[model samples]
Target: MNSNRLPLFTRADNFVKDLTLTSNQLLLIVCAYIALILNLPFLFKSANAITGLDDFNWLFLITFPIFLFSITLLIQSLFAVKWLIKPILIITVIISTLMFYATLTYGIVFDYGMVQNTVESDSAELLSYLNLYAVVFFIVFAVIPAVLICSIKISYQPFLKELFNRITLFAGATLITVLIGTIFYSNYASVGRNNKDLIDYITPYKGIDSIYKFARKHYFYPPLKFQLLDTSPQIINKNNNKHVTVFVLGETARAQNFSLNGYNRLTNRYTANQDVISFTNISSCGTATAVSVPCMFSRLNKSNYDKRLATSQQNVIDIVHLAGTDVLWISNNNGSCKGVCTRVNTQQIATTKSNPLCDGEYCYDEALLQPLREKLHKLEYDNTLIVLHMIGSHGPTYFKRYPSNKILFTPDCQRSDIQNCTQEQLVNSYDNSIAYTDYVLNQIIIELSRLSETEDVASSMLYVSDHGESLGEKGMYLHGLPYAFAPQEQTHVPMIFWASAQVSNSTPDIDLTCLKNKSTNVFSHDMVFDAVLSITSVKSKTHHIKNDPFYGCKSASFVPLPLLESAKKIQTQSSGEH
Candidate 1:
């Protein structure tokens, strides 16, 4: 060959000869394809629940054109660069990096961070956006180069020629992919869900009004003008010795694991000593704070919560207000749901200190007492209702749930990420947070007791968890499961009440001993309204007298265990049993 041709031929031969693809590159491609396949099923699943807004401005629409263009460019680049494996891999890296960042950021933004306060009905829309961006961006900017690099790595021919051939082949594939996606979207556009269906499935006739009310409460700039249903509310037993009920809402505390409920561990050493009623079987209404907090506070039942959400006449707080008691809601959790305490006097401890325990400006549950004490001191009146919402055992940041000094376990006082530690370590960190909670409650009780003594006021403290947390059970890390399918851990939480001497004196015959030894297996957050009413003797017009489940209305239902049948034999010889 001529010298000029020799140089070109030799370079081509070297490029093709040296070209090879590694397991990592092939694996990446396979993974990307798998992701695409997986997304298709997800898209189909979410399609049924699509809203009109989704149909109109789906991410697939915008990404289709870019996807086509990207695939075309990638094909062309592949055949042009004979030894472009590194360049293509670099492109893939860029695309994957962008996707990784997008996914990570998406989790953060929704996890605890806020957006423009715009609500999207389907979370899949955001995921779809990310998927579309990844597909099109990779096809356009990364594919051809990646194919060229593979060619160089795998072939023994001229780099440029190999790149060209590979690009030509892959470009065809790229076009086919884009064409398929576009055609699918185009044809399915008219078939997707619409506004009427959204109204039907999510907000029915009765629910529409409620949905509108919820929207007004959370998103409506100018609030909706609505009147309280009961204008002439009658108070029951007006003379209850200036009753004060403090409901301390604990976060993510499981009842079964609590030592107060006979758990193997000493998790409830401090609470066990207190003069309190530990309702053993108390279950949360929902698994997520967003759903549970709102549902628990709202004057709605399981059957009507969705429908009544928007139009519920009043919440528990509002009921307290109408009953002539000062209502206060102090919280540390993210405002994911509607501000349940919006109408009530609200204080947020999470946003108070500069350096708080968790990610946000949220301090531990103990911080609630700081403002709570002040609020109590400021209150000149004897009748008041204070709701202390604790940022209890919210994980996977169990270590941050409590203070560093409160760590009871030795060797490691606390850990921000329990997953990074052993199972024992994680348990220790979690239990420590619970221990701190015990201390916080003790302090609140002490303060309340002191107040009753000093000012001659009557007070009672009621503690109920919004929901329980799961600690490495069945591959689930946190709460947010649908209530119907949630495990026992997510539902069962510690419910206790520590009353002041004056208040407990009135209910002198109240039995708290059985509460310590046995399980009140039928209790739920739903009974909260009636329980509060019964304890305070506050009667409201809406208080359903007959169906009120908390008023000595224990269900005569029990789960049968064959293993317990052996108790007959064991009991016969259990005269000396401890």
Candidate 2:
């Protein structure tokens, strides 16, 4: 009996000794551990908060181990080759570092949009997001572990045995995960649908999924080509009064804070003094410029608009240009015009020679004025459209949007890291930027008024922001929240119209009073394309009169009045005051 027990003990000891992990297997194990640790925030915070208190503990107990085990199996299966282990470790380090930095600095969920932004961002934009804290954190958490992984010596199992073991482990993990998911389908689905951001909070997997989706959408997908709204748009110049329309595209300006929109603050003090018509309710096509700018200029409405189609097709500007109208796009903002100005003349103020308003990188919104005046002077067409893209209230450097003298709001937040500032300071700084935008728009209106008088051109100005912003509201700072889940602060923007006396006199069909009365009426970026087309008198097959705000103001037969009653009323009111 003693001899039999001794042989059994020896056999158990030999079995324990033989249970060693190869270098690739050890790397997989380390990666799995890191993935679990990185995703602990999602498991403990986002997921737990969404689950009911009664089910929270059970959910965690059931899902946590499964999540870790599943991740391990997935990674091991993908990186099964012995030589691929080092490359996998390096890739993991980079992804983990980025995830950590974004989670720590911006508190952003790593969704597909965020991933798209990451992939599309230039080196400068990417560098701006990095800092000392992020570097240190990456070194401590990601790089050090990666180095350790590379340094450790590993034992290699026989090829067949290793392959069989990997297949068995992966199969077991997948079967268990599917079984658990089936058993708790109700709870899992409820939490997943209710809290879609839960998936975004999961590390490595979140990044992996986002990259996969982005790649599939951008690379694997075939490029979609869309036909122009009109193959040949016709320009019918009514009265030929040298019509000139200035479209001021604003950035990060929310309607809620605009004094002209009934905000308590004096953010629109300058614009308020002018004869500008401000719209109270205007929703953006998207919550980010990458989506909004293209959507705003496309013939398709937000619901029907596809980014690929929008980017590929000729927009309002292009169609108007094709109709024999001179079009110019002047941009003070560093962001691209999102192909809206691709076919038209473009003037980038930041790259303009000896521009004082620019520091060779970022420029004030006022920088656009000089180039605009130059372009207006050189215009030889009977009708023209000039777009001024302003860098208004762009953050997290809100204080930089305006000049020092224009910082009307005191105790403004000066730090680029806006999260470090108090809420009051953030508001003050952001308000100052809005005030400067007011000043810039006022200056443009003054320029248009001067141009109308000097050049005998009927000038008008229309302002609409690409998207609104989130100023530390609900723990979210900056914009780019998914449109489906974005707050009102990121979708509701400001739109204003200012017509010169000459324009009003020449185009009588547009009733300013009726337009003013319609200020509180709901509008959106969808109106932009049709409104611009109507304003320029460019007739196209794609033009929808219902989408144009001024279409109803015209008389029967859709003809504009040669003289404006609104212009006469203004003159009468001015004369009475005098």
Candidate 3:
């Protein structure tokens, strides 16, 4: 060989020899690559959604991948034992798959609230979310990488040398990550504050961190104890007239889709024909059943409401029961009343087998009706409060909420995987659920009317949903987004009020005309506690006059409602409901 050629050949041989890696080193590299592949899509989507790929966002896109890579390397190095690699990788794959599936399917950012909901959700509810598409996606993205990692041949090195290399790699990666983070400190902080969901959108790291935080907040933290607002609430009986109030607590019903609220769809057909008063602008306390149910029943307003505090004390049910009225909570929804019904007479329709309307696990909202009628028949109290918590339009299983004969809209999405359906089909399926709810409400009203006629009972029925739902709007589906960032579709709920002639005549000061005018007025979950107390004639110091929708019904001040002025303005733009 020529002298120059020999030197080039020698250098080439040295380069090839240097490329060889020990099993630990190779595993670290594989983990790092997998992490990047799993996280990059999320990072890109989150950055675009937040900052729209502007200069500041570009900086994030460039640095975030590096940060993720370095963190994965550091983690792999710290757990560098030959036996630990497969287990860690497998766990990573599983979690990563779940995170991807949720983010893509529902457009949800896995924040602390999401983590809390996940932990609190039952097996059935969780299983309802699973489908073939999500499984396929998980296999393709997560399982494929894991399989590759497991199949690779690993060359062993001396334990001491491997340990030294692992420590050195971790230290180097940590130093680099810290340096990058420090340099972009201000930019990161600004983006994080402005777009809080960005942090939540980051894959396995965010998911794990949120779960840890949720656990700490719920389990490790000290229990919050608060005084019940109306410990000695009392109902003042006027004329000794028998009063019966049926409070229907609905699930995922939005005002925008209700014909009573000026929507084009005749979703509220039954309620429209009746003398029901529908509120056009009503916002929910929270975007999920878990939070909204407790909040609605609590004296606390949105500004002051704390989940811990809400759970600790007696709510509307306790106060109502204390006021010498028989209170009963009948629920078709799987979720409990979040401790609100702990002291009240509660019946769960989902648990009963004798009711043909129920199938043990899932049931139509009408399933609550039969149980409610039975309870009503046995009621011995002159003044009674019956709460019917309905499972109305809960999705992406909207088709299942209503029976086959009740599906008013054609081309309804039958699949649980809503993404597989067209936008029109999805809307049709959801609207059909709403129509069925209308039918259920009409049946309840008819039952109430029958009781009022047959017995000496003065009756009324009030219906309000726990929270509204998002139906494929801007790539968002379902509810439970954090309240601060949730769109109107997730918060603007429907409310209906109907009173029999006897009950109306007894409370003659509650002007029906004034209430009809105030139907277009803005209100929120904060009004519910006081409104219920006012309607039931439960006098308590805890009830705020300003929060009561009927407080100024007979006064000139009723025209320009105070609550409407103070409440959040409703967004004019509308979206499809679930």
- Candidate 1 yields a Cα-based lDDT of 0.55
TM-score each candidate: 0.59, 0.86, 0.86
lDDT of 3: 0.77
Candidates in descending lDDT order: 3, 2, 1
How far in Å is the alpha carbon of 448 misplaced in model 3? Answer: 1.3
Model 2: residues with Cα > 4 Å off, grouped in runs: 1-21, 24-29, 53-62, 65-69, 220-226, 351-354, 559-578
Show how many residue pairs clash in every candidate, following the order shown: 25, 1, 0
Off by over 4 Å in 3: 1-34, 49-60, 75-82, 147-159, 182-190, 222-226, 351-355, 507-509, 554-578
Q: Give candidate 2's total backbone clashes.
A: 1
Q: Global lDDT of each model?
A: 0.55, 0.75, 0.77
| Alpha-carbon shift of residue 315 in model 1 (angstroms) | 0.7
Name the best candidate (by lDDT).
3
Candidate 1: regions farther than 4 A off: 1-229, 237-240, 307-312, 334-337, 350-360, 410-417, 507-519, 545-578
Pairs that collide in candidate 2 are: 508-564
Stronger candidate by lDDT (1 vs 3): 3
Candidate 1: worst 10 consecutive residues by lDDT? Answer: 107-116
- Report the lDDT of model 3 for residue 469: 85
**Candidate 2 lowest-lDDT run of ten:** 569-578
lDDT of each residue in 448-528, candidate 3, tens digit only: 888888886788889999888889898889988878888899999999998877765664236778788888888999899
